[model samples]
Target: MSAATATKTAIPPSGGGLSRESHPLAGTGTLLRFNLRRDRVRLPVWIGALFLGTLSTLSSTVSQYPEAEDRRSAAGSLDSPAGLAMTGPGHYLDDYNYGSMLSHQMLGFMAVLVGLMSVLIVARHTRTEEETGRAELVRATVVGRHAHLTAALVTAALANLALGLLIAVGVGGQGTEGVNWGGSLLYGAVHTMAGLVFAAVAAITVQISQYARGASGMALAVIGVAYALRAAGDVGNGVLSWLSPIGWAQRTYPYVDDRWWPVLLGLALAAVATVVAYRLSTLRDVGGSLRATRLGSPVASAALTRPIGFALRLHRGMLAGFGAGLLLMGVMYGSILGDAEEMIEDVDELREAVEKIGGATIAESFASTVMIVIAVVAAVYVVMATLRPQSEETAGRAEPLLATGLSRTCWVASHLAVAMGGGVAILFLTGLGFGISGAVATGDGGLFLDLLIAPLAYAPALWVTAGITVTLFGWLPRITAVAWIVPVYAFLVGYLGQILDFPDWLNNLSPFGHVAKLPAEAMEWTPALILTALAAALVALGLAGFRRRDLETK
Candidate 1:
């Protein structure tokens, strides 16, 4: 052999050999450790929220129903399809106690929270990293092909495990009379399994979509569908419940039957999903997805020539998804209104509680409560939409758009307009859905008009939330993520304040707390007008700040 040829043959290629590449899971531990470090703040926040929320629910249940008679009365009132639909199956209703009551009230919400946590974590590590080109930089090192995916999965699994342990500890600390360690562990385990199942689903979804946004949307869509299915199943027959992870968790009956079988189903499905994700990961190139992206138009339409149109185009899909989910939820709540009214009439205690909460009648109170909850949920979309400008700036897209004669004011306003308009659309659709379903169910066509106007009462409150997000985005761009804490805090105050006996002042910190319970009570104009003025002021302040500050870029 030639000397040059021999020298070249003696040296190994920098990219490594096929044998080395074949072991795609190598270096997963190192990547997992890195991921844990990165997620330290995020994971703890999620776990802490779950822990505190669970503890609050447990303590509230015990305090609210201390006596046996009270417990029995509460359980009897919630035994109907409407109650079961709002809660879960209420498997422990027959032999009810504080622990079971807490479980029925908190399990579904906890499961959903954990599911959301898992989906975001998985998508952040997988598709987001790839989309941002960070994964390529990592892969250029000594990392294995599957190290990124493996690390994401392991991190999510560990997070779920930690959350489960926290929940168990929190439940045990509640020290309810009938609460047992086994039941506490079971409750935590069910939530952990539900989180794992969704994590696996997110893993598989990230593989299917090239873009991080697409992956996130797809995973959240699955969560919405699963929740809707569980709601339908709980309100009707028990068959459809078996198809959802949340349903599976609830069916475990932690404080009652303590069934272990449903957990196996979640585990089995997660395993299959993980295997499928790994297989699919091998089939696609980095930044490529199993689902093909559609080609865009070569020519721009007249609408696309404007900033508002462009903003609307970008936000339309997400707004559509949020609107649809809200509509479905509203319909679900409306469908149960008649049943809720009958149950309230039959149970004097429930009627008293409902009246105390500003319900003129059981139906109106129930509908008003549903509207408030839906409004808060829809406000989440407003926050997200408001933060879109920040996301665009960080992604390096805004700089180019600005270079093309687009002023910062116009650009920011475009996104804000979409956020405000989309928020109103979601609120309206939610009210319309409720109104239509309620009118049909109650045989009162006039119900439609009342319900339609109800959600509008909360619009000013939602605008305040959007304004806060915008203000944060403009002034404190780097820490804009802290804006999410606002909605979470609002949820805690608005939903759990009375149950936790929080002071009125603390509850009033949430804009939703300022909103008058409408349709049940006469609409108060003072708070609404004040909130509107505040929202307007905040938006103006944000615009002024954005105009003065340097544009943030990644």
Candidate 2:
């Protein structure tokens, strides 16, 4: 035989066939490099977002509370159960400085963000590629059995390390007297470890579920439950906190205790989760999951005959999850209104800041500010729902339906209807939760009606965001992922513009910035009506463009 052919046919000394010891992770290095190249844009965006979020909180806290006394007063206000529940633990309250307060405000949120990033990245590389049949092609080459999973984990690890370094540099560079470099390092380390724990969880979940969406759903549910456990523990007894990864991260109290033991717990959990994932991986086939997918109905229902009904069936799970989450957030925010009022009353600087931001009253300002934040979050869902058609088309599912009697407009309109209707339903539910909870806390029956009507003011702004996504999906299907940047920009501008003292025109770029701050100011029909008209125009333009465009598929 030719030398090259003979060499290619050669087997290992121990066996003719490849075994676990010989080839389990044979191509891990190559896969790791490939995975890095694939995620170059994605990793940078995740790291930048986490770093910027941390830095902004630090700068804002320093600027808002320059004096030690102001810091202490603010910390004291947050020591209450309501505040603890809204934020994480109040252990940082004991240290009472800019860094500590900033950590208290940002750590839990940052941890969650990193956790989500890790989970999505890992799942995207593992289950998603496998489901799409890309991993099968790669495995048919010289790749090892564990190479894909190992590469995904390594990539996630490297990304987490980068995030940690960024946090450390950003926190240390603040140069405030309150900045403790050791504590800053600890803060970054805890978040990094939190990411690792969730990455492992996602790996294990992907092994358990056949579909990428199911795996991601399971991981996100774990995160949601972890947050809930931590909140309960912080507001009540501290025992429950030990059960949650987030609670473990928060208990580190970076600037206060600077404890490193909880980090060990995170590391141990990650190790255990990784081992479990590997074991499960060995037990399952390449295209199969550890758990069997449940069987669906053999016969289609009458509702499945229509486009809208099929779209609703596809999106019902996502809509339910989003709706429940918004409702829970509304309840939490509403419960804290009384404490917020007390804090504003006790802190003169805070009161001035609120008034400067156009808060007619402290309560009105707090509620309106929260409404704006919720509206921004709702806009994210709007984009996701609107872009569902693009995802469907790229997945090749839309081609089959289009080959039938289904018109392209009908198909696209079905998804848009869900987007618009679902957005309205979620907003209304959030408002209802907030109003009910606020009424219960304050013993004011009138608040139930007032807050209920306030969220509706921002509905037009939400629709505008959806309309933009639809336009992009129609005209720029190849780069429709760029639509995600709109909500991110809107969030930064709407939430942080006034705090960062950005120019009016810069803030005006966000549609939410144009909506009247409800309850704090009178509802202006002119702006709302104008925004609605603009949204309708955008949707019409998008539909026209879509009609003439060729279908783009993967």
Candidate 3:
């Protein structure tokens, strides 16, 4: 039979009901291999970054504080509100060892990122395929129900294990005396287990939702809850923190107590979760969700008719939530700014670090700068939200809409407008909140102007991220993740390099680095305008490319 005919004949039901005689492994092994091949480049990038992060931490720690007293001062800085809120509770930083210092300052973020990578990989491989109907086609051809699911977990597990081992080598290579190789191993173990725990959670979410977006949301919610519970536990009562996966990993106390038991506990929970996920997968139909989305209004709302209106409809909720979050962050960071000045007065090294980021400045200015950094992060969400239209089009959802009466430009522009415009508004509000509160605390109304200006300084970088997404969405649609991933890499370079004492070239990649450090440094319009123009040009190029390309096939 011809390949086209064979492909057509091979598919059983579009909805993916399988026959009893179908072999689970029939098409699965090959698909797994194909997936591995596809992920070869992406996997290496992620794993390499994770290991590099660990190595950077070790090297930077040893270099930054060669003296014992310096290490103590640095450790003491952790008790301050700015440190604890930005990093985490610093209970473990008393030790001068490279491992303990890094574990206290950096490991939580590592664990969070590793888990994030694992969850994204698994969600994309499994739930996404089902959502797109590809899984149904594969499942109809003697592929076992468990094959795709199994492959996702296996792939995530393998990637995470490799990441852990690389981290182990990275930490050991630091050449620190009295280095606890065993403790380092346990450190890697704890992070790897955290990845596994989230991987299992993602698997379970995929089975429950059978859709990528929903699964991603579920996984992120888990991360958010874990962070919140852990933060509360770390700050207030220890009881709530134990409820969070992040707390469990942190409580492992990698360098101080050097406990391996918490990691095993993570493993135990992961195992149970995996088994349950497998059972659910067996019982559920492909592309079927356990929880149903409530039906929308039978008739379209009046506001849904216009492209901009429709875009606003889709993004309004998230924008509101982000705005609220920024306000909350403003209050948290602003309130802590006063406390930070008091707490860090005795710590020279800590003071130096802060001064480097933002010079000897009023606490309100420092708070405004910090809030702006966070607003930079929120810009990423804005870009992702804006790119949704492009993603939908590339995934074939836009095809039918276009086939009807919808124009491609209008639809795409709508999402972009929401992403760009909404981002600025939210950021402005965040700055307002942060600036106003900090000014009130310092009894200086001038702080409000600084706060407002800080977010404006960051606007160019935010638009650049969004513009890149839009540009990519039009051309090379298949690799559109590049738009988001590149900015993220730039962020890593800037943020982590500052922490790890990386070279100047590394920090310069992000436009954020070039933007005037508001309230901390004098404002410069040259770089800001340049970044804004670049971002606008990128969006124009993307739009031009998108207009020329044929509608993507599902």
Candidate 4:
């Protein structure tokens, strides 16, 4: 052959590269299996905890309000603007039966949980793989371009399906009044679709961000906005509600109206998002994002030079978000305080729940309840910040720093300090938020001061949560995720223990259970001091362990 013809034959044709070896979805099954195996323990815990907790809540609601009149009275309590904003639309209050009660009280919030799960799962399997550099290694094999994303979406979908199936079967088989087989199916579908939509949202976000945390943060922000839109819409005309995925699910009205069509909206949104994600994936190479990265300053800032300052810098974004979100929650909870007494007069279940929390009056008791929620939410931040060091270590970022002059204790303590201090600050901010709206509603400026101090009682508990995270990271780094149960369990029991008639032992097990119901009951220093001491001991134990163990380097 001629030299030119030989060279031409040696080069592959344009648009024909690797067509024989790889397709967009090649090796998707292999990746999916690997992702599932990695998540074996994690996914089961999510599914089992949500499944059992949901059923238990339903049964408790049914048992407590057996009579129709009782359910109606409880419904009456939820008919106000505060109820509509917190729960769902006013229509549920019309036919408020056992199933309707679950849909109204649970669906909107449950969608949030399911959506969060989807976002985390997608981000964990997709951008996290890229962030860890594992995707580049895997891509060098026969795996295709879109295999990681496809596998992640599949994993999220399967988990969501399992959760939805369990919920449907459990609720449908219960033989509860107003709950039928069809409505149960629709209920489960709502969860499944909502989760898929968020999973798709995460997929799109992963392509837009190079870091897993950034992608997940962006997706979570969407969840927050969706929830806010739903709340606003539910409180106003039903028009705004239609704009939110959460609202779409809740408006299904599961057993009350059994509007099955809204589930299709979620499915449609998920499909469109997935296609967009796939298209955007081609716009960038592996280990990068669609958006271009900007160059940073050549010199380090004075604050970033110190471990504590750097830790604060790393935590500030989340701190700001949590502060803003919690502040709004406080305002919403406090908005109803002025009318709480009059609205809850006939609702015996609510009256009992208020008494369970305990205060001089219904409004004050409700304020105390808000404090518990704020602390628990703040604990979530505490755990995340405490574990930041572990994530850095595993990612191989901490090894070089440790090899420098930085001691392990100092490095970890910096993050722990941020966690401890930020948690308490957000708690205070949340209280101030409550106080702001509450002061205006009731015309009592003193309420603001009382509210600020109310959250202080739980500061020790937040410290304890951070301590637990530190202990796990130091001694059992592989199992550090178990520390999340502290906040999750505390929030669950603290918020619902009264309504669910949870056993005293169950409630007592939460780190947050013992704090005095402040601004209502007299302040008790015993529990606060004990928790504080316990936190100190745990932190010392963790630091000692970290000093001895070798650093984990991914």
For lDDT, candidate 2 versus 4, the one ahead is 4
The list of candidate 2 runs beyond 4 A from truth reads 1-22, 346-350, 356-361
lDDT of 4 by residue, 182-298 (tens): 999999999999999999999999999888888988999999999989999988867888989999999888998789889998899999999999999999999999878878789
Candidate 3 overall lDDT versus native: 0.75
| Weakest ten-residue segment in model 2 by summed lDDT | 345-354
Q: What is candidate 2's lDDT per residue for 383-453, written digit by digit as tens?
A: 88898887677667788898899988889989998998898999898899989888787776777887887
Could you list the CA RMSD of all candidates, in the order they appear? Answer: 2.9, 2.9, 5.4, 3.0
Q: What would the C-alpha RMSD of candidate 1 be, to one decimal place? A: 2.9
Regarding lDDT, does 3 or 4 come out ahead?
4
What's the TM-score of every candidate structure? 0.93, 0.93, 0.87, 0.95
Lowest-lDDT window of 10 residues in candidate 4? 5-14
Error of 1 at 290 (Å): 1.3
Candidate 4: stretches off by over 4 Å? 1-20
Sorting all predicted structures by lDDT, with the top scorer first, yields 4, 2, 1, 3
Best by TM-score: 4
Candidate 1, residues 1-554, lDDT tens digits: the string is: 67776554445556665545456877788889989998888898888878887786676667667799988887788888878877888567877887788778778877888999999999999998888778888888778989999899999999999989888878866667878888889888988999999999999999999877779899888887787678778878678888888898888888788898999999999999999999999889888899888898999988899999999999998999999988887787778777776665544544654666775556788676556678778888999999989878876788889888899989999999999989999989988988998888777687788888788888898889888888987888877778787677777666555435467898788888888877888889999999999999999888888988997555
RMSD of 3: 5.4
- Model 1 alpha-carbon drift over 4 Å, by segment: 1-22, 342-353, 357-360, 499-501
